[model samples]
Structure formats: C-alpha cells, structure tokens
Target chain A: MGPEVMPLLENRNDIDLVLWQQDCACDRKWFLENVQGATAIIVMFGDKVDSELFEAAGPQLRVVSTMSVGYDHIDVKEISKRKIKLGYTPDVLSDAVADICIMLALMAGRNARESMAVVNEGKWPNYSWAPFLFCGRQLSSTATSQRTVGFIGFGRIAHATLARLIPFGYTHCLYLANPSSAPATARDAALAAQHHLQSVQRVDADTLAATSDVVFVLAPGGAATEHLVGARFLRRMKPTAVLVNASRGTLVDSDALATALRERWIWGAGLDVVTGEPNIAADHPLVKEPRCVVVPHIGSATIETRIDMATLAVNNALAAIAGEAMPASVEF
Target chain B: MGPEVMPLLENRNDIDLVLWQQDCACDRKWFLENVQGATAIIVMFGDKVDSELFEAAGPQLRVVSTMSVGYDHIDVKEISKRKIKLGYTPDVLSDAVADICIMLALMAGRNARESMAVVNEGKWPNYSWAPFLFCGRQLSSTATSQRTVGFIGFGRIAHATLARLIPFGYTHCLYLANPSSAPATARDAALAAQHHLQSVQRVDADTLAATSDVVFVLAPGGAATEHLVGARFLRRMKPTAVLVNASRGTLVDSDALATALRERWIWGAGLDVVTGEPNIAADHPLVKEPRCVVVPHIGSATIETRIDMATLAVNNALAAIAGEAMPASVEF
Candidate 1:
C-alpha cells in the first residue's frame, strides 16, 4: 500500500486496524490467521478471496476491497452468495494504463530495445550514425501512408488510448467488441465526431488483424478470451504491423507470438503482461525474441495512479464498514 | 541512403552517379579525391562542406544537399558566399522528432529502463508485486493534479510536441524563446485556443525550469546557445521534474545534468543527443547514471521519415543541377 493509505486507516478514531506493514504482499497464511474478527479486509490483485477466505474471516467480514480494476483473483460467485460488498478501483487507472499502451507501441515500433542496447552495452562508440540504421516502423501517418489502429476490446482505457493516438495522425480506428453486445452505429459516429477521426468502425476479428497497422489487445482475461491472439490472428496481421498488449496475459499465446516474430508474421510486439507471469523464465521464447519488448506488468505502476488506487481502496473499506456505499464497486 | 534512393539514382539515365557502396559513412579521403568534376554532391550529417571541398569539385558544385534537418556540419556562410544552393530536410522530420520527444518523456517518467531490466534480467520471478515498486512520476493529469509542460524553444518541432501532449491532459504550456524576438501575446492566445490549453505563457529560463513538471530542450545548437541548460538552470528545477533533450546536445551541459541526477535536483533525464557523441565513453557520467535513459541520436530515424529526407535531398540536388529552384533550400 502507499504510505498515505496506512495513516488514513490508522488515524481514523472509530476504527481499529491490523496492518501488514511489509513492502511485499501479505502471505496467504498470515492473511488467513490475521483476518479473523475483522469487519473489512483490503487485498491486492494477487490475493484470492474465496470460500476459504470467507470461512477464515467468519461472518464478521462485511467488505473486501481490492486496489485494482480487475478482480479475477477473487471468487465473485462465492462473494455474491455471502453478500460481501466488493470495492475496486476501475476508472482511476485508465490514464496510467493507456499511457503505457502508447509507450509500448512507440518503443516497439522504434526498436527501443535494440537502440538502448547499443548505448547500454558500450557498443555506441562503434555503432556510429547511418542514414537508415536502427530505423523501425513509423507510428504517425504521412501523405503516402495513413495509419490505422485496431483494438481487440473497446472500453474506457481503449478510448483513452485512442484519444492519445489522434494527434499522432491515426485517422481510422477498427475495434473488435464482444459479439453479444450489438454494434451501436450512433455511438460509433459520436466517437468519430468527438475525436475528429476519419472513421471508427466495428470489425470482425480476422479483419481487425489484417487491416490494422498496429493491433492492441485490450480485452479482459478469462477462459472465454484465452489465446484470443493466437496463431490465426497473428498470421492474418500485416507484416509491418506492431502488437501491443497492456491488457491481460491469458488473452495472448506466448508460443504463437514468438513464432509470429520469428517468422516475420508481424513486425514486433510490446507486451506488459505474459502468461505465467511473476515467474517468467529468463529463457522464455518471447523474452529471447529480438523484436519483442516486454516489461513486468506495470500498466498502472505510476506513482500518482498507485497512490490513488490505494487511497480509493482504503476509503472503500472504511465506507463499507460504516454500511455506506463504496466509491467504486463491482456488481458481484 | 535508403535502398530505394540508390535505385532512384541508378534508374535515371540523365544523371551519372558516383555511389559509395558501403553500410557505413564514406571516408573523407576517398570523397575528396573522387569529386573532381561533380555538379552536385550529396552528403550526410557527418560530412563537412567548406572551401577545400568547393575547390576539389572545381567550382562545378552548384548544389550541396544534405539528408538532415540541421546543417551544423556544413559551412553555410561559405556556401552562400560561393553561390552554392544548400538543400536540407526540415518539415519532413518534425513529426518523427516530436514522436521521440514524447517517447523519451514517457520512458524517463515511467522508469522504463528499470522496469524492462526487471523482466529482461530475470528479476521478475522474485520481484513480486508491491504497491509502489518501480513506481515513477506520472505524465498525465488527474482531477487533483493538473500537468504543466515547458519548452526551451517554441518552434515547429516544439509546437508538434505540444499537440501530442494535449491529449495527455497537460493544461498549461510554458516556453522560453530567443530573447531578441519580442513575445507575441496574440500568438500565445491563439496557440492556447488551438490546443484548448488553459494557458500558453512565455517566461524566463529560470521560471520555466522551476515551474515545469517536465522540460524539453528543443532549441537549435550553436555557439550562442551552447550550454544553455548549465548548473544554474538545473538547480532551480523541481525535484519531481524530468528533463528531456531531443534537439541538440550543445544546448545542455552533460556534467551539470549528471550532478543533477545524482543529487536528486531532478528526478531523471531522457536524452537523444549528448555532447561529444558518437565517441561517448562507457564511463561517461550521464550514461553511468541509473536515472538517465539515453539512445543514439536517432530523432529522425524512422523508415518513412528517413526515406522522405533522402528522397527530398536527391530531388533537390537534381533540380538545382538543372538550374531550377531546389525543392527545399536554405538561404544561408
């Protein structure tokens, strides 16, 4: 938690807090034992709030607040049955995550990994200037090539990313939304008008993969969306296109992505999340790929955004303990 | 030159081309000996053009075209005195260079160098989640904290960078220009209106350094402006602020910046150009700083941009040799 959040919880005159003061996440065993007799417990994205956790906390558990937008770690079905109010931070982190999306897109397309290596590994002295050396794909549009940006999911964060791209001269946007939701023509037109884009169209997955100069996987991660950017999608993409994923790890297949880069199916990839993360091997295929730029999941790891998320989580916990509504909450 | 440039020169039956077929820059000794009777000579940024070169070409050098925006490598005064038309690429690369300015800002503020190391160096397995781990400064605005961006020179490239920053929620823009030119309030207001900014104010160097959250050095490089961002200017800056230099290295003193980062006068720096570049030692002070992120001076090194520059340079040479006005020319 942020330094401010601890004081916010401890300074409340009406509340008594059991704080896990370490920098790392609280251990599962420590959480289960210390959570007893608590009215509310604050958790992180790595924690699981399940039947086991509910039984450990007893009937006194009234609220479970998490300092993240997604609650995949928690068992929503069990939490709903127990009627525990779930508080989470969603809108607070859109700008931070969206910022990383552009950073990754620009970095990957600009060959940042290779260029930095030249400077960092002491090869810059020998690697002098050339006209086209170290050149990569251009993100912005020119008269000859108008840029087209595609999204796997079009939510709030995606919208924020699109707004940033408009000034870069991306005139067209093609997105793949959940098929269950109808394509709203009015909303699409409004979005186009708001950003002054040439076109904003809903497209099928294959078309989105083939047409976009840059493809962003911003979909939610779950069983339904697992391996959504697998071989078929990679194969359909333009050879010059770049891929960026500031979203979930499960939505992309590592093996497929590695093959795509190796075979030149796509130009490059900028990934914030990977499958089996937090224990990713040094020799992971995607990690070894020259064209792939990967970072630890730092989509919302800005100082301001992290503090805001922590503050919101603490506030939600305090509000739910007083039987009031959370500042932000999940339906479950 | 790009692959296409060689073909563009070779396919033209009307022109006889002397091509240096190599990946690296042409050797100066070889260039002088072979240019005995050339009407036009195309050069890279590393080449110098002066009286000796004009004498070697036997006064047939009517045009000296360079594949860059900056003509610091060429002797513009002598070229103008000798009635030689000088051609350079300017507007073609503004977008590309502006793209890098934002890239550096995002990379420095978000600690991309550190975060990538966590994954790339195999530290991710043990570097588990913590609230503030790897957290750096935020670039965008929130309801509580609006953003202020500053520039050292408010030219075309600076304006392009400002356009990119608007969507990042920067509300105010402060800038320092050549003091000889009078401030235009009408122009400032017009710029503010065009970008929907809260304010676009002209200020002194110290005020720009002290008030800005991020300061970009975008001025031209020369003796008059050398070391403009020296010790005194760095001292007045916000501790949380970031400094980005994409314009020219002569504008900033590298030693002063090194001390600033070490002593926490500023949070970090992102640099594309450094003083005494292309031969920067491994133990160079700025390169040794953990808070600094540096790349080779590749501001206009995008495939599309470089090709445009090269194409423009070639066309300018051809037109000037034919006694027609060059496509893009420098008056001095």
Candidate 2:
C-alpha cells in the first residue's frame, strides 16, 4: 500500500474496519497484507481488485468504492453475485468539467497559446497588421449567424456545456448518444425550448462525426468507446471545425486527431484528458500538432466543485459503512 | 505624406480627392506637383482648406471631401460658401466601429488580458484552484432587466453598440449626447424599439460618466469632444465600471485614464484609437497600465467591413467629382 491511501485508512471513524490498497508494487506481497480482515475496500485505478483479491477478502467485504468514475479496476460482476454495493461519483463534477470544456473550447478556437507565444517572442512589430492575421472564429457570439455545436454523448456534463454555449451564440446542437436511449428526455426537451433548437437525436457516429462545427467528446471512455473518433471520424469533420474533449481520452485516437489538425482537415482541438495519465511526452504526436491544445487533467479542478465532490464521497462512504442508503451509490 | 497613403495615390482614378492631411506633408507636396489639373482637392485632419487652395485650382475645384467624420479640418463654412459640394462617409463604418466597442467591453469586463497572462506565465501550477480567481461582472443580456448600458453619443455607432450588447446580457441603455440635440430622430425610433430600449436622452457628463456599467465614447472627435472623459468624469465613474473608446483618440484624457486604471478607480478599459496615434511610445503612460487593452486602431479591419469602407470612400470621391449626392455624407 502506498502512502496516498494510508491517510484515508487512519481517518476512518464512520467507515469501520476497511481494506485499502494503493499501488506500491504489482506483486502479491502488497495486496495480501492490505486486505486482511476488512469489510470494505477503497482502491485506486492502478490496483488490481480481481477475483483473487475478492476471494482473499473472505466474503466479509460488502462494499467497494473506487476513487474514479470507471469501475474497470474492480470485477463488478463478481461483486454483484456476492451482492456487494458499489459507489462512484458521476454528476458531482459536471460544472468543473464543463468549465474546463469551455476553457479548452475558447483557448483552442481563439489560438490563445500561439498568440501568447508570439507576444512572448516580442514579434508584434514584425507581424503585419493584416485583417485576418489572428482572427480566429469567435464561438457563436451574437454578431455571428450560423453555428453548429455538437456533442458525442448527451450526458450531464454535455448538458452543462450547452448552458455555457447559450451565451456564446451557439444555436445548433447535434448529438450522438446510445441508440436505445429515449428520443427526448426532459433535459433535451428543456434545451430545445431554451435554444429554439430543431431536435436532439441519437444519430449514427458518422453523422455526428461529420456535421458539427465544434464537436465535443463527452462520451464514456471504455472498450466500447475506445477510438470512436478515429481516422474516419476526423475525415468527416469540416476543415474549420474544432474538437473539444473533456471525457475519457481513450475515445479519440490521438494520432488521428493530430493528423487532422496538421493537415487542416479540422481547425483545432482542446483536450483536458489524454489517453494516458501524466505520461505526455515532448515528442507525443498530439503535443507536436500545432492546432492541438492540451491541458493537464484538471477537468474537476475548480475549488467549489472539488470540495463538493470530496464531501459527497465522504458522506457516501460513511453511509455505506453505517448500513444506510448511500446518497449517490453507483449500482453495478 | 507617408507610404501608408500610397495605396490611395495609385488608385487616383477611383479617388478624385483626399481629405486627411495630418501626416500628408511630403505626399501632399508631391501630389500638388504631379496631380496638376485635378478636378478636386483632398484635405486631412490638420491641414486647413481655405479660399487660397480652392482659388489655386480655380474652376477645376468642384468638391472638398474630408477624410474624417468631423468637418473641422475642411472649414465647412468656406466650403458651403463656395458651393463646392462636400462628401464624407458616415454610417458605413458604424457597425465595424461598434464591434470594436463591444470587443473592448468584453475584454475589459472579463479581464481577458490579465487572465491569459496568468495562464501563459505558468502561474496556474503554483496557485491552488479557486472559485473567484478571475471572476468579473458579466454584462446584462436580458432586455427586461435594467442594467444600464450608457453612451456618450446617440449616433449610428452608439445604436450599433447597443445591438452588440444584447447577447452579452445588457438590458438597459442610457445615453448622454449633446443636450441641444434630440435623443434620437424619428428614423431610429423603430431600431430602438427592436432592442427593447427607451429613447436616448441627454444627461450631464458627470451623471453619464457615473452610472454606466460600460461607457462608450462613440461621439465624433474634435475640439468639442476633446477631454470629454477627463479626470472629473473619471472621478464620477463607478469602481467596477469599464470604459471603451473606439470613436476617436482625443475624446479621452490618456493621463486620466491611465491613472484610473492603475489606481483601480475603474475596473478596466479598452482603447482602439489612442491620443497620439503611431507616436505612442512603448513606455507610454496608458500602455503601461495593466488594466488597459490597446489595439492599434483596428475598428474597421474586418474583411467584410474594410472592403465596405474603402468602397464607400471611393464612391464618395467619385460622386463629389460627378456632381452627385454622396450616398452617406457627414455634415458639420
């Protein structure tokens, strides 16, 4: 167990006698010593909480709360068979994530980074004052007429993203969600009324991939959604379109996006989450792409949002240990 | 006089005369020598057009066009007396200038420069994410609510500026034009109604300077408006207010504005036309002020807008030469 999870373990007053493991190593010594005589476990994504770990818990473990949204770190089916509860925070960080989404959208579309580099390099005088020198698209201000704002997934964060776009002159919203979902939920109906939009639908990946002026990737990032916006999707986007990603980075193949931006198939991109965490290198294909804007995974980094998330996670853990209904329990 | 006006000279067939002479020393001398038997004379802001220049051209001088909104440089009294038709391009550049007005409003109110500097300087890592880090007052977008958007003039540009504010959450409009003139002519009443705004009224400079969340100087520049937004007006402005000057340079007292921005008396400011023009030094008082965003006179620099302005200017020159009414003429 690493030191990161040790603090949570020592501070457990309401969550009684739990197993916790942080990734210090990939072998049995760390895992076996960590889960002894525990009723619940808090694991990070790096830890392997498979059948072996579950069997080692000896049927005493009743709840598993991962510190991330994705539960691929744990075997959910086995836990469901054992009737163990599950918990994850989903909508709690929507506002924070939406903030990042907008930040990326504005930064990438406006070419802020490149402009700043020019200012830093003290080349203002050398640059000609041509009308279109750095006049990037101004995301749907009142002064503009046509706009096409798109979403890869119509989820809580995407709804929040739309709220921000309303003020910026976003009139059109195209969505590609799961085909089995209802055609019009209350949120979709409300958004339609608010924006005077045409319709919200679960279109094929190709339609969503093609028509949007600013395509936002807000879909789940797992095996099913991996590389959803690959070479074909990039080809479908307009030459002037911008792509924003605040969801799982795995949904986009970085190489494809980099190629699109470099070849001017797409205008630019803003990404808060990358395919791998903290492993972005100088020579990363996307990093070298001029139109690709990247930020450290700070989607849920706003102070207000982070506090709310922490408070909710603490309350859920306490409620689960006390045998009460968790306020935001995630069902497997 | 300078190379900047070479484009005007090369297209002499289209432009019958030039009006602005502020920097036309060498060029004016050369034009007078090479442009013999010309049908008209062009004057600028600083040069005085009197009976002598008209007499020099004799019967050939048929028109006098000033390259400015104000006719102070033309000696309009003499032009009217001479019965030589006058030409000025007004209303054509209003929307473009108004766009700059709103751009300044947003940039100042949102602290764009400061926020971007923070991000560009790598300060985000050292600072803990906070809720109100760069929050500023959002402009009122709804018309039903009365968040007053005031103006120093009630002309075409001011009306256009109000239209730009509709999407930015601006609801109300108050203006302080020349008290001697009516708030708005009957022609613009319908336009005012479209914005859900009341008729413009004349307010004292102090009162107009005090109440506006964003005060725009869209009035013509010359002796009358010079120092209109001086220290006295700055003293009356709200601490959270933003000031935008796109009409002319001398309307605002640069020293007073710099002091206001530096001392935090006013929130921020955006200036397209600075007082001294190209002579502004790197360490000029206004340039050093962090709260000020100075763009180098790019009011009508948009692709769609500049072509229109140049076309109108060319047409005005031709009309004055052909003894036809200029489509849009500025009067004294």
Candidate 3:
C-alpha cells in the first residue's frame, strides 16, 4: 500500500492486516498460509482468485476487492456462488485509459515508433527531408468534411474517448454496442448536438469496419470478444485507417493484424495489450511489424490514477468488512 | 514533387519546368547552371537562399517561395533588397505541429520511449508490476484543483495547443509573448471565459518557468530567441514539470536541457527539433538522455499538412510569376 492508503488502514484496532510485502508476486505458499482467518482480501491482476484460494480462506471471507478494472483473473462464478461481495475499480481509471488510447492512435497514425527508431539508429543525419518521407495520416480533420471514429464497445471508456476526439473534428461516431442493450438514439443525439458533431449513431460491425478513419477496440476480454478483430474485419477497414486497442489484447487477432500491416491493408496499429502479455517476446510478430506502435500495458499507469485506484480498492475492502455496500461493487 | 503536385506543373505550355529528380539535395552546381534566367524558384529548408543564389538567378528571380513555415534558411534582408517576393507556408501547419506538441508532452511525461524500450528489449517478463513502476506525471487534472500550462511564445500554434489542453482540465494559462506586443488583458479575459479557465495572463519568463506544470517553447528561431531556455530558466522550473519544444531547435540550449534531465532538475523533455539539422548523432547529449523523447524534425510531417504546404508553395510560385500578390508573402 502507498503512504496515502496506509493512513486509512493503519491503527485500525478492529482489524488485523497482513500484507504480502514483497514487490514480486506473492508466493502461493505465503498467500495460502497468511490468508487464514482473514475476513477480506485485497488482490491485484496477478493474483488468481479461484475456488482453491476461496477454500483456503474459510467461510469467514466476506469480500475480495481487486485493484483493477478487469477481473478476468478472478473466478466470478465461484465468488458469486459463495455470496462473497466483489469489488473492482472502474470509472476511476476511464480517463487515464482514454488518454492513452488517443496517444496510441496518434503514434500509430503519425509513425512515431518508426521515425524515433531512425533517430535512435543514428541514421537521421543521412536521411534527406523529402516532401513525402515519414508522412502519416492526420488525427484531426483539416477540411470541413466529416472524419469518422468508430468503437467496438460503447462503454464508459469509449464514451470518454469520444469526448476527447470531439475537439479534433471527429464529427461522425459509429459504435457497436452490446446486442442486448437498448438503442441509445436520444442519448447519442444529445451528445452529437452538445459537441456539434454531424451524428453519433449505433451501427453494425460491418459498417464500422468499412467507414471508420480510426477504429478503437474498447470491449471486454472473454470468449465472446476473443479474436473480434480478425482477418475478415481487417480486410474491410480503410487502407488509411488506424486501429488502436487499449482494452484487452485478446480482442484482436495478432497474426491477422500483422498481415494487414505487412500487406498494406491498413495504415498502422497502436496496441497497449497483446494476447500473451509480458510473455510477448521481442520477436513477437506484432513487435516486428514496423507499422505497429506497441507499449506494455500502461493504460492506467499515471501516478494520480494508480493512487486513486489503490485508495478505492482499500475503501471497498473496508466497506465490505463493515457489512455495508462498497462504493463500487460488482452486480453479482 | 509528388504525384498530386505533378498535375499542377506538368504539360503547362506557358512554363518549362526543370525537375530535380533525385530524392537527395539538389546539386549546387546543377542549381547554378540552370538558374541563369529563372523567374521564380521554389526552395526547401535544405536550400540556402543567399546573395550567391540571388546573383546566380541573374536579376530575373522575382520570388523565392519556401515550402516551410521557418524562413531562417533564407537571407530575408537580401531578398528584400533585391525586391523579391518571399512566401512561406505557415498557418496550414499550425494544427499539425500543435498535435505533435501534445504527443511529445505526453510521451515525455509518461516515459513512452523508455517503457517501450523495456518491452522491445524482451525484459518485460522479468519485471514485476510494482505500484510505482513506470508511473509518470498525469497530463490531466483529475480533481477540481487547478493546473497551469505555460507558453514561451504565444503564437498560432500556442493557441491551438491551449485549445487542446482545455479538455484535459488545464485551468490556467501563462504565456510570454514578444516584449513589444501589448498585454492582451481584454483578449485574455475573453479567452479565459470562453475556455472556462481561471485566468490567462501574459507573465514574465521567470514566473512562467516557476509555476507551470508543462512549459511549451513555441517561439520562432532567431538570434533574439536563441538559447531562450537555458540553465538559468531551467533552474527555476519545478522538478515535476515537463518542457516541450516543437517549434524551433535554437530556442533551447540542448546541452543545458540534457544536463537538467540527467541531474533530475526537471521531470522530462520532449523535443522535435534540436540544435543541429539532421545531424543529431546517436551520441548527442540530448539523444542519450533517457528522460528525453527525441524525434527527427517532423513537427508538421503529416500527409495532409505536408500536401497542403507543398500545394501552397506551388501556388505562391505561380502567383509570383504572374506578377500577382503571393497568397502568403512576407512583408519586408
């Protein structure tokens, strides 16, 4: 815990806190031994919150609060079955993640990675300033004509991203929402009018893939969303369009996107996440693709954002232990 | 010339066009041999416009149109003395350069270069996800508190940059305009109201350096502005602050800024231009600084912006040849 969160937890006579203090991942043996008699546990993305861990924690375990927005590491079904309250930090991180999405989009479209490589390789002096050299697509629309921005999932982060793009002249927004969710025409119209955009419409995947100048994948990671942006979707995208994935790596088919870039089917891609993250070697196909600007998952890595997340996680754990509702809790 | 510009010049019965076909710089010998009776010459940054070039054109050169915003390469005094019209592309590139300024600020503050390097080096798997690792300063003001952004030179590009930062919750703006220009109190008040800012004031250089969270150098390159951001100015800046220069390389003392970064005097710096042209070697002090996110001089190297600049340059040359007012002529 940071100094900010330590104040909230320290000198609490009612509760005993046992922190897995090492910077490295908490050893499984250490976790199992120390988790005994604990009423609640605070976890991170690295921890596996499965039935095995729950069995060791005993029936006294009332809550499992994760210091992240994504709970893919947790076994939600088992937690729900036991009626243990679950809390995952969300909304608080939307701004930070949205900021990175814009950065990636600009980096990919502007060829920042390749251009910086030229400077780092000591070849800039020899490279002549040609009229067309190192030129990439513009993020902002210069002309009066509309620029289209599309989203795979119109969630909180997607909405925040759209808000940022408004100033850049992204007049047309097309998003594919959850099929079960009701149409948000009235809301979309209000947003469009507020930002003075041409339109904001809920569209099908095919239309979004074909017409968007920039495509952002902000959908959740699961079997349903796995490989959502595959060969068929890549083939339909505009040749000049940029693809940015700041959400989950599994949403994109890495090999297909790599082929799209290699074959010049798309301008470029900016990705913060990949299918097998941390384990993605330097020789990974996406890493070797010159048109791709890949960064390690750092969507919410800003100092302020991380502290907010940590504080919220601590607050949620404390609330659940007090037999009260968490400020942000999973519906289940 | 690109394929788009070729149509504008090709097959013109009135004017014979001699092309410098190679991607490399035009040979000085070839330039002199062919320039005996040229009415107007379109030049790039690489070509020097001096008394020698004016004499080679043999008193017939009516205009020298550069396809760039900066005319530091042109001898303006000599061009004015010879009564030659000088045209430069300026406003058309402001949006592109402003976009790059924001990119650099975020990149430098967020350690994009260094963090990406970790992934590229295949060391990510070995590194643990610590609470404080890879965290950098936040670009946005998360709470309802104020964040100040300072500008070294408040010009078209500076205003555009300020417009972008408003959405990021920058509540106050401080700028140091040219000393001779009157303080824009009324105009600044109107701007502050329009952007919902606390204030937008014209302040002294020292105050700007001391209070700004992000200081942008958007001044022109000339003897007056040379080394404007050196050790004395840097010493007053907050250690958490970021310095971004997308305008002119000469506005900053590269060695001073590099030392500041190395010694942790400031948070980081993002520079598009350096002291030298295309000659910043790998061993260059600024390039070697880990806190600096350095790129080749590509502030306006977007496909749309470059095309517009080239088209405007061609139009200015044609206009000068026709003895009409050039679209963007510099007054002597």
Candidate 4:
C-alpha cells in the first residue's frame, strides 16, 4: 500500500495490518499467506480478487475494498456468493477523470504531441513561422459557426465533461444513453437550459458519429462496450472531428482507430486508456500514429483525487471490519 | 501567402500585385525595389516596417497592414510620422490564443510533456502504475479548496481565458491591471457578478504571484514588461503554482523560469512564446527543463483564426488603398 493509506492502518489496536512494502507488485505467494485469517482485504487495480484468494482467506473475510472505480479485476460472482461487502471509490474520481478527458481532447485537437515532439527533437530552429504551420482545429465554439460535442455515455463523468465544454461555446450536446435506461428527454432539457446550450439530445450512435465535431468515449469497459468505437464508428465520423477516450481502453479498437487516423477518416485522437495498458508497447499502432496522443492509464492520477480515493478506501475497510456499513459499498 | 487568403487578392483589375514567390524570407533588395511605387504593403510578424522601408516606398505607401496582433516588429513612431494608417488583426485571434492558454495551463499542471515523453522514449513497459507516480496538481477547483486564477494583463484574451476557467470551478479571479488605468472597483464587481465568481479584484504583482494557483503572463511584449516574471516574481509564487505564457515572450525571463522549475520553486510552466523565439536553441535552459512545456509560437495557430487574420489584413489594405478607413486600424 502507498504512504497515503499507511497512516490510516498504522494506529489500529484492534486489527493487524500487513502491507506489500516494495514498489513492485506483491508476490502471489506472500499475498496468499498474509491474507489468511484476515477479516478484510484492500486491493488495487492489479490485484485480482477471485475465488482462489477468497478461499485462502477462509470464512472470516467479510469485505473487500478497492481503491479504484473499476472492479473488472474482481470476480463479482464469487464475492456475491460469499456475501462479501465490496467498496469501490466512484464519484471521488469523476472530477479528475473529466479533467483529463478535456485535456486529451484539447491536446489531440491542437496537435500537442507532434508539435512538442518537434521542439524536443531540436527542430524548432529550422522550422519557419508560416500562417498555416502547426495549425489545428479550434476546441472552442467561438471561432466555428456550429460546434457539436458528442458522448458515448452520459453519466457523472460525461456531465462534468459537458459542463467544461459549455464555456468554450459548444452549442450542441449529443449523447448515446445506455440501452437499459429510459429516455433522458427531461434530463437533456434541463442540462441544455442550465448551460445555455443550443440543444441537448439523446441520439442514435450513427447520428452522434456523423454530426459531432468532437466525440468522447466515456462508457464503461467490459464485454458490453468492447470495441464500441471500431472501424464502422470511425468511418462515420466527420473528417474534422476529434475523438477522445478517457473512460476504458477496451471501448476502442486500437488498430482500427489508428488506421482511421492515418487515412484521415478522423482528424485526430487523444487517449488516456488503451486496450492493454502498462503493456502498451512503444511501437503500438496508436502510439505510432502521428495524430494520436497516447498516455498511460492516468485518468484519475491527480494528487488530490488519488489521496481522496486512498482515504476513502481505508475508511471503508475500517468500517467493514468494525461491523458497520461501508461508506461507498458496491451493491450486488 | 497560403491558399486561404489567395482568393481575396486574386482577380483585382485596378490593383498591381507583386508577389514574393518563395518559401524563404523576402530578399531585402527585392522588397525595396518592389515596394517602391506601391500604395500599400501587407506584412507579417517578421517583416520590419521601418523608416528606410517607408522612404523607399516614396510617399505612395498609404497603409501598412500586418497579419498579426503584435506591432513590435513595426516602427509605429515612423508610421505615425509618415501618416501611414496601420491595421492589425486583434479580436479575431483572441479566441485561438485563449484556447491555447488553457491548453498550456492544463498541460503544465498535468505534466503532459514529461509523461508523454516517457511513453515516446519506450519506457512505459518498465514503468509501474504507482498511486503517486506522475501525479500532478489538479487544474479544476473542484479538487482544490480555493482556486485562484491570476493574470498579468486582463484584456480580451485574458478574459476569454477566464471564461474557459469558470466551468472548471475557478471561483476567484485576480489580475494585475495596467498602471495607467483607474482602480476597477465597479468594473470588477460587475464582472464578478456576471461570471458568478467569488470575487474579481485588481491586485498588485506580488499578491497576484503569491496567491495564484496558476499565473498567466498575458501582457504585451516590449521594454515596459520585459522580464516581468523573473526570479523575484517566480520566487513569490506557490510551489504548486503553474505559469503560462501565451502573450509575449519578452515578458518572461526564460532563464529565471528554468531555474525556478529546476529548484522546485515552482511546479511547472507552459510557454507558447519565449524571448528570442525561432532562434531558441534546443539546449536553451527553458527547453531543457523537464517541467516546462515549450511549443513554437503557436498561440494563434488555428486554421480558422489564421484565415480570419489573413483575410482581415487583405481587407484592411484594400480599404486603405480605396481611401477608406481600415476595418481594424490602430490609431496613432
């Protein structure tokens, strides 16, 4: 565990704490042995919470708290069957992730990666200042006649992202609501009125792809959203549109988006998450694409947000161990 | 000139157009020879409009319209003496420059250059996702207790930048106004109410630097503001504060900023303009600072803005030639 969460677990007299002290990943053998007889376990994104680990912890383990919003690494089925309470940080990270979403959108649209690379490679001296050199698509609606911002998901993070765009004179907001949810006409109307947007409508994927000058992938990652922004979606997008992915890596197809960028199907892309993260090779197709600005999985890497998440995770574990309700429990 | 403005200059029956048909700088001899017997001369940022050029034009030079906002390159004193109407594109590019200001602030606060460089250097596979690794200061006020945004000059571009920050929850606005202007008590109050900000006040340079979470150097470039953000000002800033320059390069001392960043006196900086630009070496102190994100002067380098500037320059010159007031004339 990081030092941010260390103080919370240090002075507890009623409970014992075992931490993986090194910066590297904890040894599986060590984790299995240390988790024995523990009433609760705190895990991060890389640690898999499964039946094998739960069985090793015996019937005494009552809860599992993760310092992340995504629980894809956790086997929900096994935890549900065991009636183990699960706590995951959610709303605390929305602001940080939304901030990065806008950052990536601006970076990708403004050609920051390539332009900065030119400076870093010592090429600025030879480059002349022409009217058109390094010109990029403007993010604000002030310069454009019409600006449409589209989102794949309209949850907390999406709303936050929309709020940021409104000040930039984004006139229209289009989003694809979850299939399971009812129509969001009232919600859209309320948002439009509050932000003074031209209109906010829930549209079909095709319309969202075709009309949006900038598209944001803010959906969850899993089987339901795997490759949601593949070749078909890319092909339908405006040639001047910019795509930003700050949600989950799996929602986008790396190769397809790369090809789309190279072929000029879309203007550019800014990405924080990729299909396979931490392992994203330097020669990955998305990284190799000049129009693509790729970063490691750092959507919620802000200092304040990470500290808040750790504090919440520690408090949730403490509450569970004390036979009290967790502050942010994930319902089965 | 690029294709965007060619149509405006083409097919003019009554006008004689002398085109400098090369990508390189216009030769001095060619410019002097061609400018003679010319009624108007359209210039760019690097083209100097001095007494010698004015004399060479032989009283036929009715106007000098530059395709840029900055007139530091032009000899305004000589132009005024010769009664040459001066035109420059100002408000047209404010949106573009403002957009880049916000981009740099977010980029600096988020460690984009260094983090992206890590990925580009083939080091991602070896880097682990730690809770604190590459963690940066959050740009939004939502994550911060009290967010303060300060500006050295609060003119069109600065206000445009402030508008972009409102959605990010920047509650307080502080700026160092021009010394000649009256105290903006009523104006600041009106602006505060209009923007729904906590307060908007004109403060001193020291207070602006000390309290601002992000400081923007947006004042004009010249002797009056040279090295305004030097070591003393940088030392007064919060260790977590970020400095952004989208206005004039001469307003900031590059060496001071580099030293501040290296010594951890300031968190980071984002510069769109720097002193002695286009000639800035790759080994320059500011360029070598890991915390500094340096881009070639591209504050107004957006397709829409550039086209608008070029069109405005052409129209201003044509209007002057026709014995009419230029659209955006700079009064002597």
Per-model lDDT? 0.89, 0.66, 0.88, 0.88
Which of the two, 2 or 4, has more DockQ? 4
Which is the winner by TM-score between candidate 2 and candidate 4? 4
Q: What DockQ, on C-alphas, does every prediction get?
A: 0.76, 0.08, 0.70, 0.66
Q: Per-residue lDDT tens digits of candidate 2, residues A1-332?
A: 22332455467664455332322323465666767666766554446677788877778776776545556666777888888887766676675566566657755665645653443343444444332355454554324356678899888889877765664446778888866777777777778887666665557878877777788999877787889889999999887778999888899999898888889888788887678645666567876765676765666643344444545555566567779998777775
The CA lDDT at B300 in model 4 is 87
Question: How much is B38 displaced in model 2, in angstroms?
Answer: 3.4
The candidate that achieves the highest lDDT relative to the unseen native structure: 1
Docking band of candidate 1? medium
State the weakest 10-residue window (summed lDDT) of model 3 chain A.
Answer: A137-146
lDDT string, candidate 2, B1-332, tens digits: 23333465566675544333442232545545534566765444434566656655566667765544546556667777777777665665565566566656756765655654453344434433232345444443221235667788778778767765654445566777775775555545665677556554456888777878889988877777898998999988988788999878899999999999898889898887778664565577876776776766656544444344445555666687777888767554
Q: Which ten residues in a row have the lowest lDDT in candidate 4 chain A?
A: A137-146
Put down candidate 1 lDDT per residue, A1-332, tens digits, no spaces.
76566789878899988888788878999999999898999999988889999999999899999999878888989999999999999888999998899999989888888888788877888975688888888888765778899999999899999999998999899999988988789999999999998999999999999999998888888787899899999999999899999888999999999999999999899999999898887799998887899989999998899989999999999999998978998984
How far residue B18's Cα lies from its native spot in candidate 4, in Å, is 1.5
Give the fraction of true interface contacts kept by model 1: 0.67
Worst 10 residues of 4 chain B by lDDT: B137-146
List TM-scores of chain B, every candidate: 0.96, 0.82, 0.97, 0.97
Model 4, chain B: what is the TM-score? 0.97
Pairs of residues at least 3 apart in sequence or in different chains that clash in candidate 3: none
Better of 1 and 3 by lDDT: 1
